[model samples]
Target: MGFDQYHEPPEELSQKVRTFARMITSLIEEAEAIGWYEQRISVEKDPQARAIMKNAQGEEFKHFGMDLEFLLRQKQDWRAELKEILFTTGDIVKAGERGEKKVD
Candidate 1:
């Protein structure tokens, strides 16, 4: 089966690289699912159905976080950069600038 995630020849890519690509794809899918759930929850008339959608959205958020953490573990520079930006309260643009400098 052809995997669309790889821009290069899959046979030439390392196993680690292939795993990274799969995880990245998974992350994107999870994020998209979260957005879809958000829209559904917003318009849902049934309270129980909305609650279920919210719960599912929460799971997607967890999946996205896990995938991001895994990817970060593979790249120290990325982890370092995000450390300067994540979970901090301040100007987002400035935080991003700091993160860029850290990676630089």
Candidate 2:
């Protein structure tokens, strides 16, 4: 019920920008949920509760991935940068540097 996501006047922004902002908010919420579940699972001693938390955490992961894919599809440079850094087997910093080069 809060319009905290919009730093500027929402009426002045394009529909596409609004949609992007909403997705970014969703992505952040999903990430926070995932982290919360992780912490809960770590402290939870009950096996059933832990299992349920893990399952919910996995669902959050899926949502996060979907949001990321949607955002990446909207930006070719983001896709290229992620492609260079993600799923690779070398140093991550080096891969990020490579990704930056791709963006540059």
Candidate 3:
């Protein structure tokens, strides 16, 4: 996603902008989890794989930062919920990779 993709806000759109902020944060959270696992698995002291994952993770961080800035500017109250969801998703991804069974 590029800065050019951001459209100018209309004068009367409040609720929808809030919803878009939430959606973008959720998408970024999912992406961060995926990148974390890819980084964790691509090992073997292989410089190439390590380099690739490093760049990918950095991009994910950039994405997260963008969403965070939007949230701060548009929906500060939603930040806590979004952060918790991101951390929970990361934990789930890590557990699944480890073959850990989820307890009902």
Candidate 4:
């Protein structure tokens, strides 16, 4: 089966675009791993197993952040929106609205 990241022909895509697609795929995998660990930790009966899952999840989440940072660096508008939406105290919806306005 073909990779989901490439909607178009791979031969037609530039190397930079392919690398970006790979990174996006990686980011999705990291996020999925974090969610999976959360579910496992929630249902796990053993404290030690849950602790290990939590630690692993923390690492996965860190990878997710790094992936997001990489994407932000590549996209100026996204970087601007995230700057407004993240680390601000208030209604989250309001922050998102403000962030959207920032790009427009």
TM-score winner among the candidates? 1
lDDT tens digits by residue: candidate 2, 1-104: 55999999999999999999999999999999999999999999999999999999999999999999999989899999999989999899999999999899
**Regions of model 3 farther than 4 Å from truth:** 1-21, 24-31, 34-44, 76-104
Q: Whole-model Cα lDDT per candidate?
A: 0.95, 0.95, 0.59, 0.93
Task: Say which prediction, candidate 1 or candidate 4, comes out ahead on TM-score.
Answer: 1
**Candidate 1 Cα lDDT to native:** 0.95
Best-to-worst ranking by lDDT: 1, 2, 4, 3
Query: What is the number of residue pairs that collide in model 3?
Result: 0
Write candidate 4's Cα lDDT for 1-104 as tens digits. Answer: 78899999999999989988999999999989998998999999999999999999999999999999998888999999988889999999999999999999
Q: What is the TM-score of each candidate against the true structure?
A: 0.97, 0.96, 0.43, 0.94
TM-score of 1: 0.97
Winner by lDDT between candidate 4 and candidate 2: 2
Question: What TM-score, to 2 decimals, does candidate 2 have?
Answer: 0.96
- Model 2 error, position 8 (Å): 1.2
lDDT of 1 by residue, 1-104 (tens): 88899999999999999999999999999999999999999999999999999999999999999999999999999999899899999998899999999889
Q: What's the count of clashing pairs in each model shown? A: 0, 0, 0, 0
